[model samples]
Target: MPTEPEPQRPPVGPAPARHELDAERLRAALVRGADPDAFYRRLDVVTETASTNADLLAAARDPGTDRRVLLAEFQHGGRGRHSRGWAGVPRAQVIVSVLLRMPGIDLADLGWLPLLAGTATVDAIRSVTGVDAELKWPNDVLVGGRKVAGILAEVAGTHPEPVVVVGIGLNVSLTEDELPVPTATSLALAGATDLDRTALAEALLRELARRWQQWYVAGWDVTGPAAAYRERCGTLGRRVRAVLPGDTELHGVAADIDEQGRIVITPDDGGEPIAVSAGDITHLRPVP
Candidate 1:
């Protein structure tokens, strides 16, 4: 079988003045009109890194830490689902990783974290940039049928409390020529008039904080989040193909997102609806 080609990296050049995120301004904006003790209570922006998720996961956990959001201007080793590389020009994307600590709960419930991040991103993009964003099942955020962002969740700790790092990479101002692939798009290309990474960051964190607080207080209930996610999801009701683990493939129509956060697909084979624990899903268009 032929291997898939690696995604191209954005050509390395001097970081443009128009793309820099002001660390101070972003922190201030996040704190305004928000509870001081919110889950997304801390913020850090760096110039470069291998991956924000890796750095925060490897760092010594601070006992006083709440949810800390880490952003990097450029990432050389960033990854998405299935370990696919994600890269972009310095300061041209809203690359962030948030460390979330949840109370002890059933392991299956942890799946909601990634979905929460996806829904939050869609709402944030729509709220901040006026772009109509939608969530593809699992981890993708799409605008006008092009992928604009991806979510990756990594487990950090799970003994005393379940801790997960949710990483989100969004193309902010990449030109047409800079997209890693033809299917990818940036806010600029998606008709977002304002490309301020700071504003987008503030909006994203605020949404995450608000929704996360509700989930935490409710003991990780999926009722509200699941319903909201289904509404924002573009995958439901679409004919699709999902590549499950062990390279098995299933053709189906995305039917629903169950309480455990897995996608329930009605198989094309006339079998019963099955909830996939995890998979790489591709939405298939109807035959005209």
Candidate 2:
């Protein structure tokens, strides 16, 4: 029997910046197995919006604006997990941010939301790109040892009615030169050449919605998705250095994420165990 030839993929390059998509096409594409009006209600699509997270925050604070979804083709001022600036490849990247209303929940418990969003994104990317992406410590997705996606979750307002905004930035199709960092990659860069930004974005949102609903119903558990989160987390049992606020630094082996989702680190010096509530983690070794 003859072997079948592999499909030839396009060369690595930035996808063209599309100003807009036909409303009809967009409506049809976004309506898969979703509520008819659900897609219409939270679908805020823009050609050149600055940052979907920023826009979602502004709308969430407004009494008149309904809690909705924000999607931008490109983000001029997009930010990541620690206020880091991010660049998008126009139509090749997905810059989506969603707003959720959490009533009566303490602001602290919201830390795990980004992790959930990251896991959901991994599921979506795997389905669309056929690549098994891993999550870096807190919430960055890596493909073939290179960063391909990231999640940023921020909370606004105090108790009573708090608004949580989840921002997702993914590299669907970017060239090597356009990638901001050498350690970063795109779906196309890591042998997943069938990348589609719009399709990937919609899948991410749908999967994210599913995970969010589960988390909301289960109410934080050591099992469930959080347990699955630990399985795919790239930082587990790896030597790492964490830079905390006020220039304090801790070097250790990432033991695990506790039931509460705090990163548990065992110091390399064999001193004491430290739990980092929030900080930047640098895994000494590349993703394996």
Candidate 3:
């Protein structure tokens, strides 16, 4: 009767926490069901970095590096338009940067790159989270009038071929207390039930690639992309204040975005419409 010996059980600890994006899983998902020669030639997921943009920009200097994507689980020194710093919880956001070497594209059309990125971000967020995300001028992605994502495009190098690095930082599962500012919101906070970073990143990259191809094939034409951006831009037709460089300010109604991607504003003082190439926009509330 000694045949039935008690089986020894190994001790079990607490269950391992789940991550929104397993690096390997994310990499596999990005390449799966995608074209073999897709614009995203390489996908890298890092545990932490000063900035994915910085990493990709450095890689772009090699000349051999092109269409490389770098994603970070957490970014301690991330930045946005105007040198503003951005931070998000580890594994709770999609922080990515892409390197592109556009040799034949006209330099004049380079102005539209940020807007194109903004448009792609809006589309991806809307499709993935069911949130009506909109663009704020050149780079901010807003949902319900709060910033959920931001895009930054920088010219990395231009000696042999023009290399541009575009970075996108999207908040996914931060809680109310984790928000950097009152005007910031995350997808989870915005009521997105599916906070899957892998799916979100894939959707964003696909949209960006599609838009990039369209822009490239059109010889960097702004007509199509401009219209698409205007349709989803919440700044247009709203009263706003433009904090121009050097502390100059202009208060006006955001009339439209010109073909060059500048914000055309009709000054409130009845002055001529001014095209703002760069400025900080503040949406003004209507006076009672």
Candidate 4:
């Protein structure tokens, strides 16, 4: 009796060459139309780093270190919300962190920093690659419901002027197999035509700067960014499960984002709505 050939695995192909970032080209582009009074005073690109967020957080301890931008071609110790581990393919993602003084922002409103980063990143991805990216509440950026970027905002100083280090890790050229997890996607896998690191970095910084400047000028006003975030937030108007610290959970419909950037979840069982300041959220369904 003839038997079907033992199930064969797909043939493996050689991996593509790792693209190294051109710091000289990036620096030149950033300086050609440089704004003397821009929020970003200095932009530095590094070949590799333990963690750009940690480096910038340490820098923020010195008042003079405000307004500096640090980008790493690779992050060996990158992290996301809840200290989730992260790392990037060499020059395949925009791994950047920005340090800024709080500029008299209220403590309660600090949550918006990471949210703002998500919004900025989504917009940047769209602008640079023509890919439609959306936000997953506070920190994750998504393309077609799969994670594409993660944002982390750490508060450093807390005296005369509090400083924050906002780090963004965006997957630009990661192949499908290189995705951090099965639930994640990258611009490359999402069919983006432009994967140039310099162009993506420029777009990310520009969009981030524009949004940060607006929020800063308003003295940390949540009105504008909040509206913009709600618009881009895919979590809103969906059924979700909010998991707070210690594994506590609340199942409800994502109603609205409050002034302090908390996601308000209204329980479908006629229970009172609750606002979550920090937690993990799983999108369940679109609210009908």
Q: Count the backbone clashes (under 3 Å) in each candidate.
A: 0, 0, 0, 0
RMSD of 2: 6.6
Over the stretch 185-272, how does candidate 2's per-residue lDDT look in tens digits? 7787777756666677768877877776676677644356678788889789878888888878888889989867889999877988
User: What does candidate 4 score on TM?
Assistant: 0.90
User: Model 4, range 39-123, lDDT digits (tens) per residue?
Assistant: 5677889989999999988787677877788999888998888888877888778899988787788877888888888888888
lDDT, candidate 1, 1-288, per-residue tens: 222243453444432346678888777667533546545567889889999999878752654554788999899899988898877688789999998878766777888988999989999999889999999998799887789999999988887777888999999888777889888988877767888898898888889888888887887778989999999999999888899999999888899999988899999879999999888888786534
| RMSD vs true structure, all candidates | 4.4, 6.6, 12.7, 6.1
Whole-structure CA lDDT of model 1: 0.83
Error of 4 at 202 (Å): 0.8
Q: Of the candidates shown, which would achieve the greatest lDDT relative to the real structure?
A: 1
Worst ten-residue run, lDDT, model 4?
1-10
Candidate 2 vs candidate 4: the lDDT winner is 4
C-alpha lDDT of all candidate models, in order: 0.83, 0.74, 0.82, 0.81
Off by over 4 Å in 1: 1-17, 31-38, 60-63
Q: Write the per-residue lDDT of candidate 3 for residues 17-93, one digit (tens) a residue.
A: 32856666655655533545556667888889999998987787686888888999899998877798877678878
